[model samples]
Target: MSDIEDKKNSLIEKMGSEIITLAHGSGGKAMQKLIDQVILGFFGQPNQGPLEDQAIFDLSAYPNHSIALTTDSYVVTPLQFPGSSIGHLAVNGTVNDISVSGAIPLYLTCGLILEEGLLFKELIEVIADMAEAAEQAKVKIVTGDTKVVDRGSCDKLFINTAGVGVVNNSLNIRIPNIEVGDKVIINGDIGDHGVAILAARGELDLQTTITSDCQPLNGLIQTLLAEGIPIKAMRDVTRGGLATVLNEYAQGVNLGVLIQEAQIPMKTEVRGVCEVLGLDPLYLANEGKLAAVVPAEYADKAVEIMSKHPAGQNSCIVAEIVEDHAGRVVMQSDFGGKRVVDMLVGEQLPRIC
Candidate 1:
C-alpha cells in the first residue's frame, strides 16, 4: 500500500515461471525478488525497517509489561480447507498460544517450506491470507525465510511460525490459579474443525455442510480481561481438544473436573458425524475455541461478555472444578449417567490444526 510495497510487488512479475522450481531457492535475484514481493508486499515492512536475519522491536512502548513468546509448525493437509487455509491457521494458532498466556500478540515470524513445482499463484494467496489473519489479530509479520525442497521430499507446503507478545506484569494466568468451584466456560460449539478436516480429506467418503470455526480470539479474550472477569486459567481447545485440556488442568492442581454433556455445545451435523463414526466429540479438535475457568461469582459475567462477541455467541458454562474424584475428569452424560473422560490415547484426527 506504500511506495515501498508498490516496488516490491513488481518483483513477482520478474520470476521466470508461474510455478516454483529449484531455481527459486537458489541464492539469486529470483529468490530475493520472490520473498520481497510476497512477504513485504502483503505484510508491509515491519517497524519501518528492512528484512534481516532477525526482527527488531522497540520495547519502550511496552514498558512495565512482561514478554511472552510462542512457536508452532503447521502441516495441515490439503493446504486449502473449507473455512480457512494453512496460512490463516498458522497465524491464528501462534497468536492464540501467546494470547492464552494473557499476552497481547504483537509480532510474528513466518518460515515456509515449499515443494518443487508448487503453484506461484497459490503461494501469493496463502501469504495474503496470513497477512489478513495477522492484521485481524492486531499483529505484524516481522521476519521470515523460505526453502524449496525436492518434489515428494515434503508436502505441498509447510509453515512454521513464532509469536511475540506483551503481558501485564501483574497478570499471571496459570493452572496453579485454578481452584475448586470454579466454573469451566467455553466460547462456542466444538468439533467443527476436526469434522471439517475429515471431510476435506475424503478418506472416509463423508459429506456434510460443516465448516471450521477458524478465527482469532485475542479480541474476545482481551475484552474479558479488560472487564475484570478474573479468569483463573484459560487454554485454547486445540490439538487434543477440550477433554485433554480439562484433564491437564485437573491433574495440574490434583482436583476433579465435572462437565455436563448437555451443556457442552456442538453443532448437529458435527454430532451426527461423530455418532455415525463412533467417535467421541469430546476429543475433537478446534481452532477458534477456548476454555476459560472462572470463579462461580464471575461465571455469569464471563458468559455474558463472551456471548456478545462474534467469536463466542454460544459461550456458556459447561463444567466446573470440584473436590470429588480428585485427579480425574468426569462427565454427566445426556442419559443421566456419569463417566470418566480420559485423555486421548492416540490422535483421533491427524494434521488437524
Candidate 2:
C-alpha cells in the first residue's frame, strides 16, 4: 500500500472507526453511543455528558447570570428552494428552537461543510442569505469553521450552527406544564417546508410556487409573551412535522390531544402537493412555525396577540388537551370521523430539515 493509505489506515485503527453511519443521526441509543464515544469524548466535558436539547450552564455563578446553549446542523437537499434557502433555514431553525425555550438568541457559530467542485458563487449566495437572516433574527455569527471534502465525499453543502441565548426573566416554559383543557395553536399553515422541497426537486408536478415557511419566530413568541399570555409549552414543528411534535408533548404529559381538521390551516398548494404525492400533511416538515399550548382562558388572547404578528397572522387554535386516550393524538376528520395520529416510525423524506 501507498504511504498515505497506510497512514490513513493507522489513523482509522487508532480512532476505532473507519466510516460514519446513519445511527449518528438517530436520537436513540446508537446516536448516544456515537456522541459519547466519538463526539463527546473528543470535545465534551463531564458537565455536558447528559445531553439535553440545549446545554444549561450556571452563568449566574460566573457573574453573567444564566445562559442556554444550543447547536444544530442543516442538511436539507437543494439548498435553494422556494421562499427560503438552507442558509436562512439554518438560522431560523436554530433561533426559533432557542427562542421557544424563553431565551433571546444572542450569538451564533457557523460551520460549513463544502464539497469539492461545488460552485463558489453558490457558496457565496448561501452565506449571504445566512448573514441576512441572522441580521433579521438579531443574532450575530461570531465564529465559524470551514472544511472541504473530496468530491462525492460530501453533499454540495451542509451547515452546522451553535447559538447562545439569554433566558428571559418573565417566561417559564416547560413540557410538563401542558395540561388537560390546554389549547393547542399553530402559528401558520403546516407542511410548507416539505412541500416546497418536494416541488423544488420535481417530485411533484404541481406548477404553483409553494415556498418554504422558513423564518425566525423569536419576534412572534416575544410578542405573545409580552402580552402576558400564559404559554405552557412551545415547540417549533420541524422534522417529523406536527404529528410527531404533538405525540411527543402528549407522551411527556401523559395526556390526550384532540385536533380539528377544519381548524388546522394549510395552504391550498401545499395540500394539493401532499394529496398528489400520497403524503400526510401532518408528517411533513415545517421550519418557521411553532405549536404552542396554553390554558383555555388565555387561548383567545394568545390568538389575538399572535394574529397581530406577521409570522402568526394565520395562527389558529387547532387542538386541545384531553384526559381521554392518554398519550395519544386524536384528530377529528373533516368527514366527522376521529382518527389517531401517531409518531412517524421511519423517515418519510430523508435529508429534509
Candidate 3:
C-alpha cells in the first residue's frame, strides 16, 4: 500500500466517533474507509477481492446461471425533480447497480418512508412513476413496505430498493478483470441529474432547460452484453459521479486511469450550473449514466454498441487504463496538463441520489 493509504488507515483507526457525518454517506473516500474499518472489519478479515456493486452467487444446480443482487436508497430532496421522481430514481438506481454487474434484473422490492404530512396525491404520483419506470426496465416490483413517521421526523419521502437479477454463467466480468490498455466508455452525459436536481430546488434562482438524466439502464446494458464486447467491468456513476467511479476502478485494479477532459461527455447546461455554483461536474452525481471498462480492441465496438440504445446515444470513449501511477485517476486537460482526480472530500450536493 502507498504511504497515503497507510496514513488514511491509521487515521481511521485513531479517530473516535460514534456519530456519522454527511461525508460518511457521500459514497466517497471517507465513506469507503468507514465501511472498511467499521462495517466490513467487524465481520472479520474481509474478502481480499475486487469490490463490485453487486454481490454475485453461484447456483450449482443451474450450471448456466448465477444471481446478482444489489440495493440502493434514494433521498434526493424535492422528491419530484425535473425528469424523475424519488420513486423512479429508486427503481432505476437499484436496477442499474445490478445491471452494471452483467446481470439481467428480474425483480425489485421497495421500502418507502413517508413523512406524516406528505400529500397522498404526491405519494400516488411517485408510485405511479415507479410503476412506469419498472415497466420500462422490464423488471417487476415483486414486494414492498411502507411506513409513516411524524411530520418532522423525516423528509417528505425516502425510497429504498433491493434488486435481484440473473447473471449469465458465461460472464465473468469483475474489477480485477480491468487491466492496462483497457479503454473506459461512458454511456451518455455526466452531471445532468445532479445539476437538474439542484436547479429544481430553486435555491440559486438559476434558469435552464436541463433535466435529470434519470432512466433505467438495464435494456441498454443488455444490448451491450448481447454484443459480447469483452467488457471487463461496469459502473453506474451515481452518488459520486464519473470521478468516483473511475477512482474506484483504479483502486480496485491497482492501476492508473487517464481520462481526457475534452472527451468527457457533459451538457452545457450542467457545466453552466456547476460554474455558477462553484461545483465540479466530475464530483457531481448522475443517475442514468454508466461507465464501462473493456479491452482496447473492443473499445470502439463498446461505444458503438451503447450508442445504438436510446439511453446510451451520447456514449463516448472517455479514458484508458495505464500501468503508471497505480491506484490513481489522472485527468488530462485541453492545455496538455494533467492532475489527479481524487474522490470528494466531503458531501457535494447532499441528498443527491
Candidate 4:
C-alpha cells in the first residue's frame, strides 16, 4: 500500500475500534508521515534552522536578564468561542503568564493531542489560529510535538504550550514585593471571557453579545517597564477571575486587599447577566485582563500610561493594598456594605481555558 494509505489505515484506524494504534503513537511510519506535511505545513517558518529535538535560542543579548518559562494546557470546550478559540488561548495564555511575570516573551512550543476521528479541516483551522496568534504576539513556535489518541480518549482536541521569556534582574515583581498602600489596577473590563463561553454553550438558553477578552498582554507589560514604573506584583486574571487573583495577593503578602465594588469595571450586559444568573462577575474568568499592584508614587502614572495603550483603555484603580484586616480580601459593596471576598471554593466553570 502507499504511505498515505498506510497512514489512513493506521493513524485513523477504524475510529471507534482500537483507534489508537502503535503506528500513531510509537513514532512509526504513520506518525512520521504527518511530521513533514501537517506539522511543518502549519508551523514551519523561514530561517527556523534545522529540525531537531529542541529549540536553541541565543541569549547573548540578555546579559543580566533572567529567563522566565511557563507552560499551560488548553481544553476549552466549544473549541471556537465568540471572540477567541482554544488555539488563541493556547498561545495567548502562555504568553500572558510570562508577560505578567514582568518578562519579555520570546518563543513558544506547542504540543497537540488529536483524536482519531477529528477532522483535518477542524485541526487545520486550529493550527492556523495558533500560528496567527503567535505571529501577532511577536513570538515564534520554535518546536512542538503531535500525538494521536483513541476516538473517545480525549475531546476533539487539546493543546499544550510552553513559553520562554526574559526578565531584567533589576526588577523585582513578586508577591513578597507587594507592599501595603500600593494601588491595585486592572487593564479594562472583566468577566467578558467567562460570559462569552457561557453564552456560546447555549446550555442556559441565555442571550447576549459578550465576547471573550482573550488577548496577549506582553505589549502592555513592555510599555509599563519601558516607562520605568516599578510593579509590585502582576497576575493574569484567568480561571478564577479578579476576586481570586486579589485574594492571592492578600494572602501572599499577608496584607488586606480592599476593592470597591463600585470601582470595578464591567459592562452593563455582563453585570445584568451575572445578577440574573446569581453569579458574581468578580469570580468569572478573564483572559485579557490583568491585576497589577504598583507603588503609590507611580500609581497614577502607571494608570495614565496603561490607559493610553490599546489593551488598557479602561484602566482604573479598583483596589488598594491595606494594613487593616491582614491576609483578607474585603470589598466595600456598592450598596454601602462590606463583605469578605473568599477564594473560590469549587470550579465555577470547567474547561474554560
Tell me the deviation in Å of residue 29 in model 3: 47
Model 1 agreement with the true structure over 249-327: per-residue lDDT tens digits: 9999999999999999999999999999999999999999999989999999999999999989999999999999998
Off by over 4 Å in 2: 1-65
Of candidates 4 and 3, the better by lDDT:
4
lDDT (Cα, 0-100) at 189 in candidate 3? 87
Q: What is the descending lDDT order?
A: 1, 4, 3, 2
C-alpha RMSD between model 2 and the true structure: 11.4
Stretches off by above 4 angstroms in model 3 are 1-63
TM-scores, each model vs. reference: 0.94, 0.81, 0.82, 0.92
Q: Who wins the TM-score comparison?
A: 1
Question: Candidate 3 lDDT (Cα, whole model)?
Answer: 0.80
How far residue 279's Cα lies from its native spot in candidate 2, in Å, is: 0.6
Among all windows of 10 consecutive residues in model 4, the one with the lowest summed lDDT is 11-20
Q: Write the per-residue lDDT of candidate 2 for residues 1-353, one digit (tens) a residue.
A: 64323433443455443333443344567446544443333234344344554433434533433577899999988989989999898899899989989787877877777776665446545665776688689887655555656778888889999988887665678999998999999998999888888878776465867888999998998888878888889899999999998998899999999989999899988887777778999999999889999999999889888988989978899999999999999999999999999999898888877
lDDT of 1: 0.88
Q: Candidate 2 at residue 37, lDDT?
A: 46
* Candidate 4 lDDT over residue span 30-125, tens digit each: 677556655675577787768899988898899999999999999999899999999889999999999998899999999988887776556655
lDDT of each: 0.88, 0.79, 0.80, 0.87
